[model samples]
Target: MSISPEKVFEVAALGLGGNIGDPPAAMAEALRQLDRRDDCRVAAVSKLYSTPPWGKTDQADFFNCCALVETSLEPEALLDVCLSIERGMKRVRLERWGPRTIDIDVLTYGTREQKTEKLEVPHPRMTERGFVMKPLADIAPDLPVKGRKVRDWLEEADIGGIKVAGDQDWWRAR
Candidate 1:
């Protein structure tokens, strides 16, 4: 079987979440910004989900989702893009796992495993965070990021109080 060059694109999964400001709108803007990039294409998005704050409990509940994209950019470069989007949204870091305007994490890239000062693929604690796993399972259930499929991990994750929200996509309400 001859592989067509047209079929080549690295799949990157990004986990988006926020508790401050208009999160859905922020996330939508991030998605649009990502799709607008030349190095990437937003291929799939999970339905938005509501989940209680993970490490920081006093903040408002977070709106979360996962974006699946096909990109030519390498892992760290993709991470730079995600951070740029977060900074554009005015993310503040007053504390570790603190509440923020937005958080865009590079969950994984094409089964890669890496750790560096700038980024970590497979997102270190992703499998332990139900807020990350649930929506991820929604869009790419069969993705083998680690040894297990996203859906399989979701079955074991307890990210807590995660519920689907309606009427939103890459173009969410303003």
Candidate 2:
């Protein structure tokens, strides 16, 4: 079967979450910004979830979700786009696992395995974070990560305080 060039975009998954400000709104805006990019398109977005803060338990709960994007940009460039959007949304990095206005992580990129100072595909810590795994499973249950499907990792993740906050179209709201 001849593959069409138009069907060659790489599919990437992004994990988005935030605990400060209007997190849901910030996340929605971030998704809109990505979809506005000429080289990227938001393919699918999972339901919004309210999850307990990990690592730093001093902060408020976080709103989290995952999105599948079809893009022509390379993995690094896509990560750059995500970072740019976070900056645009005023994300402040005070400390590792600290609260922020918005945070976006490139979870996977077209089945690639990459490690760099600035980015990592199939995010190294994804399997251990229920906040990321649960939402990711909603959109791409069978997606492979570290030789395991997202659903599989989710089965082993600690999802104690996670609860659905909105439907699949949650990102459509302001």
Candidate 3:
């Protein structure tokens, strides 16, 4: 769907990562693509982070980060955009928490709360993952997730091996 100039924008948070191939390059391209869209604009991006794998834990560490986007699309539509970005970057769902070229997750959409068969907003597991929270804190430390600030959650999240891999302008590189 195309957005007109008069469309109202909503601020949304996104979690992005990957463990295979040139994940950082793929992620930067994803952001560039999103920023080029008429319906969306990347407002803020967090620093890149090298973090231990979560969930499956057996694969290689992931390069992770978060982005704040101002978009005119609704929750489901935003999710569709994210999925399209992933697919375009050769993302494949071979296994749960397995390796991939790129992964983009919609963490929040304004103050909206949604749970549908295809997507969920304020991502159901955002608070439980340090990979998501740590980078998220860099861009939106005071942003609330489930009534608690992201920084507050960061304090409790297990960020053991997570480390900054790049500065906030990391996404600007080709």
Candidate 4:
């Protein structure tokens, strides 16, 4: 069966992370797949960084980054795409903050406020994750979060070392 295209919302932000396998490579592949989706288009990508794992630090440090996508898919549908990418990368949900091949979370879906058993808009903990905020600021510094700019949030946020993974096409198709 084929899927029908819907009117895409102008902008969306997705947070990507992983600590297993080649994290940078997995992140890049996720972006490539996302960009290939008919209902979504990757508009921008933030610099990659390595950070101490949140929730649990016993595992390997996480490679993290964020991407801006233009899409017509609703929040849940968008999330499905992310989950598919994670599964394709062999993500194992053994424990919270446990090592995985890939992890993708929707940070924001346009400016809409939504809450359901399955998903939440403006990600419940976006402000708390340095991995999410740092890259978010890199790409959309002036973006408003809860009526305040992302830069302001970053300044007040308890964020630590975040190194930019150089090389723009590091994950591009050959």
Can you write out model 2's per-residue Cα lDDT over 27-108, one digit (the tens) per residue? 9999999999889999999999999999999989999999999999999999999999999888888899999999999999
Clash pairs for candidate 3: none
TM-score of every candidate: 0.91, 0.95, 0.96, 0.91
Model 2 poorest 10 in a row by lDDT: 2-11
State the lDDT of candidate 1 residue by residue for 47-143, as single tens digits.
8988999987888999999989999999998888988998888887789888888889999999888899988888899999999998888789999
Winner by TM-score? 3
67-133: candidate 3 lDDT, tens digit per residue: 9999999989998999999988889899999999999999999988889998888899889999999
Ranking by lDDT: 3, 2, 1, 4
Error of 2 at 124 (Å): 0.4
Error of 2 at 50 (Å): 0.4
List clash counts for every candidate, in order. Answer: 0, 0, 0, 1
Q: Which segments of model 4 are wrong by more than 4 Å?
A: 1-6
- lDDT of model 4 at position 79: 93
What TM-score number comes out for model 1?
0.91
Assess the local accuracy of residue 56 in candidate 2 as a C-alpha lDDT between 0 and 100.
Answer: 94
**Residue 11 lDDT, candidate 2, scale 0-100:** 96
State the lDDT at 35 in candidate 4: 88
Any runs in candidate 1 off by more than 4 Å, and if so which?
1-8, 167-174
